[model samples]
Target: MSEYSQNLRASYEAVWGTYQQFTERNEALLRDILVEGEDYYAIEARTKDLDSFEAKVDLPEKEQKYKDIAEVTDLSGLRIICYLDEDATRVCEQLGELYDIDQEHSVNKNEQLDPDQFGYRSRHFVVAFPADRAALKENARFVGLRAEIQVRTILQHAWAAIDWKLRYKNSAEVPQHLRRRVFRVSALLELADDEFSSLSVSVAHLRDEYERKVDAGDLSIAIDRESIDIFIEKDVDLEALVALAEDIGYSIAPNHPNARDPYGGVISTASLAGMSTIDEVRTKIAEVVAKKEPRLRQVFEAWREPDRPPRLVVSKAGLARLAIVLSVEVPQAVALVEKLPFGPKLQSALLDVLRNG
Candidate 1:
């Protein structure tokens, strides 16, 4: 080993601990930031290993221009893998806000590709603790050290991995005949990424529109995951049934294990019952509230005991589903009881009330 190489290795080794700590701290911060917003795929970090560091320094003498190890901005690396392109962009913006970005070295790989070319697409940020943070006693050690943050959608990350395996950094590097085919594959992935982003935005807009319509009493907006949620939140009949059940000591546990898909379960039950619009759901629930209200209490009492609580706990959404099932005729209601999300004991208690009524 050359004296210069040994010295460079030692320099990296001396700060490797601090770099490791930096990645851990920053990774945690990134997780907290991302958690406050939409869901993300993953956040990962690593300190460049000794061999990888050596490989960079051992590049041909002409290419080995780093006289100081600090020039290597990626000695510590972090990756934020998101589900959508807009999420990746949002992460990049958050990174910029949280750290001092070295704008000169940082690059958006998406922009680097011309319209006609595509291979790798990610947002790379060379970042370090900002002046204010670095001035803090605990952050002083991370003052001068920088880390590379790579933000990419899962699709882009997959493409990058496949591109790495193919050993082609870009379309320009491939043989002329093969370049066209590679570009085609790359174009397809880019299109899929854009489509996914578009679908995500559309879903968000639709959810907003559904909530607005449901809040405005527009039950004609068809039943769906979003509408079902807003409908349950605002539905008076559903609330009334839940109040009746609660009056009988039946608890509404929104976070229970069985409550995971209360909204989705209603969608399924509503489908089987042939209720397509929120208005239909409301009317059916109101029917149960008016006529079958006593039967609903009977089902609740069947599950309760003299000195004990009810064996099965149902959520408000569950109450809506129960009402919908009981609204149908006895034979159909009995058949649909199995479709509702309940354990055997509770379903049996519910079935008894439906059939014996």
Candidate 2:
């Protein structure tokens, strides 16, 4: 290695640990922001090692020479891979709020692309801890160290990873005959990313509308996962069944394994009982609770472990399933139990209880 490069490597080795510490702290801060309810693919942090630092400094595209290791912005790097493009944008805004961004150096590669050009797109931010944060003793070592944070959606990340493997950094770099194929694949991924983001917004809107309708006692909304969630939250009849179980000396456990997909269980129970609408499901539940509370209690008891105490505890979905069983024929009720989230051994025991009674 050249003397200049060797000196730079020694300087890097001296501060590489500090860069690692900086990225670690910054990653924690970023994770705190994400835990506010954003879903992400990953949050990764790294301090460039001597080899990577040397290669980066030697890249032909670098506009100027780095006289010192500190001049490299990406000695510490962190990446936030999100599930949607909109999530990437939101995270970038949040990052700006938490860090002092070098606006002149950072770029949104999506906006930088020309109308005809295709390349991997990401939001690259050159940032350091804000003054208020850096002023603290614990953060003093990171006062002048800047890191590059890249925010990109999963699809954007996929394209970049494969594109790197292809050794074509840009559409223009591909052979002329293959350029069209490369651009087409890149465009498809970009379009899929956009469609995914749009579909997420649409789903959120639909769920909100479902909540509004279900709250208003509009049972005409057909039964589905989102609608059923709202129904379970608001339906008085389901609440009554839960209360009935409690009054019968049984605890209604909402956190049971059967509650893993309470909506799916509800849907299956309703379907098996020939109920179509949320209205029908609620009507049947009310009817069963009104006339067959005794039978429902018996069914709940049948679910108890023979080796355990006499008092019974049932999942919310389990109680719902029992109610549905009373509303349907014996054969259909057995079928519903067979589909229960319970394991096969308990299912067999429950079947014996049902058959004997």
Candidate 3:
């Protein structure tokens, strides 16, 4: 209604126009780098008119300092809400790469605050338009002026919006009772974030386990023992056999013979025996143990021999003896077998003792 109010609205429109162009360019760039399954959401930008901008000018000194207050926009600005906390970090990192950041702060109060003060969390960055940007001169009012970028997980954003509406009549007057209630709400939000993070971790672990099993070739042992039986009947190299099984969706373990976690697969081995390829190592280990009936008992007995010790020991003669027994050439055998789950060094040492004896 006032002349100053009209001028401020016009300036805000100009700033908003620049913000639109900047966000559009940045959002396209973001789409390219985000992972396939990850969620990408909207980007919003706004500029304040006189009424909103003047609302913050509480002090007499502040009012006197800016007589042409209508021209000064951006009292409150941009926000990005991501589906997950991880995504918030990703978006912030991407934003940093694109924008000329003025200031950056993270309010993860849940982590640093006392139990009493726990609540919503977000990452905020103030960014100015790049000097070289074509629109910089046209939008000179927003050139040196910084726009706030608030990045928060979806849940945090929800709490923030609700708090913004309900918590204060004005930013300056947050009564004590409402402040206490806000802290309690913040605690609940933190708990929600923690639960989501835990769920994400659990899902990731399960995915890793499934992938390992699929790679190792033991998925069928429990459901279709016949698959293992057939592979053994064909004398397939254990590792290759597992690869084949994995291609068919069967789970398998890694090559290490003494692997404590069967699904973890073998990382290294002691004997450096029959294994010549990764697949051969894994498959052979699985073949040696899959039946777990007569053959496992026999192999265990042989491995437990006072001289053999059911572990691979690394030594020249021991290695050579294993190479001879497994009928594999020394180098390939060593490479693949060394990846067994048990202590390859110990296995090789025992093998040397057996050869000498």
Candidate 4:
């Protein structure tokens, strides 16, 4: 081994624990910036093992760019894999606020890849702990250490995983014909990635438009989860419900909690009950309030417990559902309960809420 190799190994070993600390502390801090749920495919960090570090430093002069072992920026690397191409940009923005970025050395690989290029794309950011985090006693040890952050959409990640398996360092390594095929494959994946983003945006826009229509009292609009949300938010049937509750002298009110949906959940229930349009939904709610009245209020009151205040903010859409179930004309509530998207046990439990309350 060369004297340089000896010194490099010595330096690494002397602070190997600190590098490991960088992975641990950064993994924790990085996760804090993540949004809840499946916003990204994964969040992970790894410290480069000694053997891999040795191989990198020992590469032939032309291939090995490391002038010193310390120059390798990714000794401790944190990778954030996202589900969509657009998510990568969101992640980078959040990360920028949380850490110091060594932008000069980092690469945004997605921008470099043209439609015809071989698939290797991710945003690499060299990050260090922010001042506030390092100032904390528990995180102080990892203060100056840098870790690479790689962000990519799942499709881009798939290409990278396959490329690593193929061990092809460059597109030129493949025959001309195969290289052309590879280019085609990358283009198709890029197109698919864009389509995913387009669909996500379109669906969100459509939902927003639906909410707007419902807000405008467009009864012609069909009832849906999103639309029903606005209906509940505005306490659309509050006047009638409060009147009924007042007649019974039951306190429901300013704080009455709403059911998420049967209003939405009972799509099948609503359909079976011959209810479809939001106009029909409103009509059925009126009927339930007439017949069930205080009992309808009782069901929402049942949502409360011993000390909590009455949640008058009940789903009027729910009353529409209950009206359908409680209606003597149609198939009874119990029969349709079987079709809800839940297990028999949950169905039985829900039935109990309606029957007993």
- How do the candidates rank by TM-score, highest first? 1, 2, 4, 3
**Candidate 2's error at 89, in angstroms?**
1.9
Stretches off by above 4 angstroms in model 1 are 1-3, 36-39, 61-64, 175-177, 255-262, 304-312, 339-341
What is the C-alpha lDDT profile of model 4 across 1-357, one tens digit per residue? 555655666678788788988888788876766863355778878999877776666666624455555677889998898988778888888888988889898899878765445678889999887888779998777777888989988888888998888766467677787887777777788798899999889878977887777678776767666555555555455347546645553443332333333445646677766666766766656665666444544544454456755443433444345555655342356667656533343344446655664
What digit string (tens of lDDT, one per residue) describes model 3 on residues 317-337? 222223233333335544444
* Model 2 root-mean-square deviation: 3.0
lDDT, candidate 4, residue 149?
A: 88
lDDT of each: 0.81, 0.78, 0.48, 0.68
Arrange candidates by lDDT, highest first: which order? 1, 2, 4, 3
Per-candidate TM-scores read 0.88, 0.88, 0.47, 0.76
- Candidate 3 worst ten-residue window by lDDT: 312-321
Q: Which candidate wins on lDDT?
A: 1
Give the runs in model 3 whose Cα sits over 4 Å from its true position: 1-41, 54-76, 104-118, 131-145, 168-184, 220-357
List pairs with backbone clashes in candidate 2.
none
Colliding residue pairs in candidate 1: none
